[model samples]
Target chain A: MDRNIAGVTIQVNEEGYLTNFAQWNTAIGDALAAEADLALTPRHWEVLNYLQTEFKNDSPLSIRKIGKSGVVDIKEFYQLFPTAPLKTASKIAGIPKPASCI
Target chain B: MKRILILGAGTAGTMMANHLHKELSPNQWEIDIIDEQEEHYYQPGYLFLPFDIYEPEDIIKPIRDFIPHGVNLLIEKIDRIVPREQYVQMENGDRLRYDILIIATGTKIAPEETEGMQGEEWKKSVFDFYTFNGSLDLRNKLREWQGGRLVVHVTEMPIKCPVAPLEFAFLADSYFKNKHIRDKVEITYVTPLSGAFTKPKATTALQHLLDEKHIHVETDFAIERVDNENKMIVDYGGREIPFDLLVTVPTNKGDDLIARSGLGDDLNFVPTDKGTLQSKAWQNIFVLGDATNIAASKAVSVAHFEAEILTENIKRFIAGEPLNAEFDGHANCFVETGNGKALLIDFNYTHEPVEGTFPLPGVGPLRLLKESRLNHMGKLAFRWIYWNMLLKGTHIPFVSTHMQEAGKEFA
Candidate 1:
C-alpha cells in the first residue's frame, strides 16, 4: 500500500517497511524516523548508509553483521533505534526488514 | 573415466551418491563420497533424545550401510578443497581430483563462538540438543533433575532444524506435566527473532500453542554473553534472562574446511545460486543442504527435494545442457507440539506455510498448520521413511518435490 510521509506518497508494506527503495528519500526517511520518535543524528545516517549499501549489494542484514560492520556496534544500535532496533532501523532506512528464513 | 567427488556422506551427499550412481554408468564415470565420521545419524531424533523418547540406536547406523555398491565411501579427514585445481586435499597429504564436486558438508554447532557459553557450566548446567553427545547428556540431566527455571534459548538464526529448539520446549512442558512437576518448573523460550517463529501466519499459530502451553517468550533478544556467575544470558541491550538450566542452540556454521579453502561467507557458508544449487564462485562445484548460504530451511526434507532437482541438474550439466533452476526451497516439516499432537507445515521459497490439507490436498490424509493426532503419527512414521525411502532416494508417494498450492488457503 502507498503511505503518505513527509507530504509524499511512498510504497510500504503492512508493517510499514518500504517496499520500493526508489521512492525513498531523505524527507521520507526523516518522517519515518520522526514517527519512530528518533531524531536523525550523523551516527544514525552512517548506519543508514551502511544498511542502504548492504541492501544495494543484496546482502542480508543482521545485528551481528552490523556489529562487525565497524560503522556501529549492536549496543549503540539498540540505543539509537531503541526497541527492535533492526526492524525500526530498516523501516526508517526504507528497506525491507531482514527475513529470518524458516 | 571422469569422476564425481562428493564431500560429506550425510543425508544430502548420500542421496546424491545414490541418485548419480543409478544415472551414470559405472564404466564411464566414478563416484566417491568422503566423510570422516563413521556413523550416520538421524539428526531429527536429537529433539526426542532430550525427552527420552528416542534411543541412540534408533537414530544411528553405519555410514557404509547407505552408500551404494559402486560408489566409493572414503572415510578420510579433508584438509581443504583446491577449487581452481579441482581437487580435494586430505589431511594425510593425499589429494583427490574430480571432474565435478558436490559439497554437502552441512552445518555444525559452534558453542565456543559465544562468550562464556563453554565456560565452567558447559554441559553440566547449560546444554545443547543440536549434537548427539549434548542430547544424550541432556537426557541424563533431565532424568534426575528437580524442577526450576529452565531457559530454552537460541543464540542466533539459521540453526539446523530451527524448530527443534521450540519442539524441545514443548516436549519439556509435556515431560514436566507427566512427572507432575509442571507447576514447579518455569519454562521460558528465548529467541533472537521477533516472535515465536519467522513467518507471520505460522508464528500466530505457534504463538497460540505457546500461550496455551504457558511457555514464556522472550523475543528480539540478541544475546551478547552468558554470565556463568549470575546464571543468566545477557543481551546486547543489557536485558538479562536468568535460568537454573540453559538449553541453547549455539551459532551454527558450515564446516571449517570451507573457511580453510577461503570459499565461504562470514559464517563459513558457501554462497550458492539459490535456485540452481550451483556454487556462485565456481560452476563445476554444486552445493546443497546446510552447506550453502541459501534462503532455505536447513532441513533433511529440503535436501530431499533438492536432491531430486539437483540430480536432474547434474545430468544436465554432464550432458552439456543448461542447468535447471528448479530448486524452490521446498521444506516439509512436522512440528511436534507435544501431547501426541503435531502440525504439518509444507512451504517453499515464495510461499509461507498456511492452513491446508497436504499430499492428497482436499481429500485429506494430513492437515497442514493445524494440530492433530494424525500429524503426530506422521511425525513418528517419518523415522521409517527417513531410513528406508528418504535415504535411498526413493520418491515418497504422493508428495511432490515442489510446494503444492492447490489445497492451501493463501490470504
Candidate 2:
C-alpha cells in the first residue's frame, strides 16, 4: 500500500519501508522517522547519508564499514540506530534492505 | 536371530542405526527404524532461520539418505505400541515385533498445550520456529515486520536445543542493528528460569551478554495465556507484557505414542537409567535423546554422546554380559552473541561452564565461557560435522562423551 506523505502518494511495503527509492522525499523521511519514534538528528542523517551513498555506489554495508565510515564510529552507530543500523538507515534513507539481515 | 526396532529416525535413531549395525553382527541382529516424516532437519539450524542466517534448503535432508543401508527404514505413522507384547502396531496395520526396542522418539513443540497461543495471531503475530514449517513461516513474518516490540519467549524448560532462544535474541539484536531500526524495536527475552541460563557460572556470563545487548529479560514468569487480542502475554501472577510480535518456544513434550503405550510419565517422557540409557520399566527397552527423562540438557550433542554409551551397553546386553557403560550427561554448545562472534560452553551433570581452554591442556585454541571468532566459526562448522562425523557414529578425535578436567579452570 502507498502512504500519503505531505499529500504525496509514496510506495511502501507492508513494513512501511519505501518500495521505490525514487518515490522517497524529505516528507517520507520525516514520516518514517516519526513512525520509528526517533527525532531526526544531524548525526542520524550522517549515517543515513553514508548508507544511501553506499547503496548508490553498489557497495555493501556492514557494521565494520559503518563503524569506520568516519561519520559515525561503531558505538555512535549503535547510538543512532540502536535496533539495526544498516537496515533501518537504508530504509529511512530510501535504499533497499541489506542481504545479510535475517 | 534377534530383532532390534528403533523408533523415530531423528539424530539419535540415525546414529543408532550406524552405531549398532557396526557392532552387532548382521547374522545375529536385524535392525529396523521407523519415522513418519521423510525429511530430517538439523534442529540447531532452526535457530538461525528467523534471522535469515540459514535457509530451509541448508537444513533439511531425506531420512532415507541418513538411515544406514542395512537397516529397514519404515516411513509410516505409528498407531500404538503394545509394550508388554514387545510389538508396535503401525497406523497401516502392521504389528512389528522386536526382541529389543530402542525408543529415540524425540520431543515435539506442544503449542496447543498453552492457552490462547494459537489464536487469531498464530502465524500472524504469534510465531514459533521449532518446527520446519514454523521456521519458514517465521522467516517470512520477520522479514515483513518493520520494527516493534519483538519478544523472544520460552514457555518452559526441557525444550530442544536449550540455547536456541538466546541465540535467536542475539541474532535479532544484530539483525535489527544491521537494519538500522535497533531503537525502533524493543527486544525482550522472557523465560521461566531465574536467570539467562540454567547453569550458575554460564548464567552470569550469558546474563552479561543480555545486559550488553540491552535486551530486557523477564525471569520466572510462568505464562498463563497469550492475550492475542491485546497483543500481550499474561503470566499466572496477572502480569502482562505486550508485544507487537511474539516468537515463542511453547511447551515441549515427548511423543504421545509413549503415553499410549503406558511406558511414559505424565509428560510422556520415558523414564530411563541416566547412566545406561536403559528404560526403567522394561529390561529389553532402552531410551535416549529428548524422549528420555535424563538429567542432561535436551541437545543434539547429548544425544550423540548418549548414542556412544548406549551402543556399548547394547552390545553388552546382547552378549549376556553386564551393561557397564555410563553417560555423564556431557553437553557443549556455541552461544551466538551476534556481530559474527559466539561463546562456547562445555559442562556436564555436575559442572557448570568454566573459564579455560578446551580439549588440549594449555593449547592455544577454542576458549570457553568467553566470546571469540574461532568459536563462531566452530558453531558454523558444526553443521557439517553433525551430519558426516557425528551421525556416522565416528568417534571425534580428542573429544569424549564425558566432560574432561585437564584444560578447565574451576574459577
Predicted structure with the largest TM-score when compared to the true one: 1
The numbered model that scores best in lDDT is 1
Candidate 2, residue B275: the lDDT equals: 90
lDDT by residue (B112-219, candidate 1, tens digit) is 888999988888889999999999999999998899999999887778987888888999999999999999899999988776676777876667888888999998
- Tell me the tens digit of each residue's lDDT in model 1 across A34-81: 999999999999999999997775556678778888899888999899
Clashing pairs in 1: none
Per-residue error at B331 for model 1, in Å?
A: 1.0
| Prediction 2 global C-alpha lDDT | 0.82
**TM-score versus the correct structure, for each prediction:** 0.96, 0.79
Q: Where does the lowest 10-residue lDDT sum fall in candidate 2 chain B?
A: B192-201
Q: What is the TM-score of chain B alone in each candidate?
A: 0.99, 0.98
DockQ of each: 0.48, 0.01
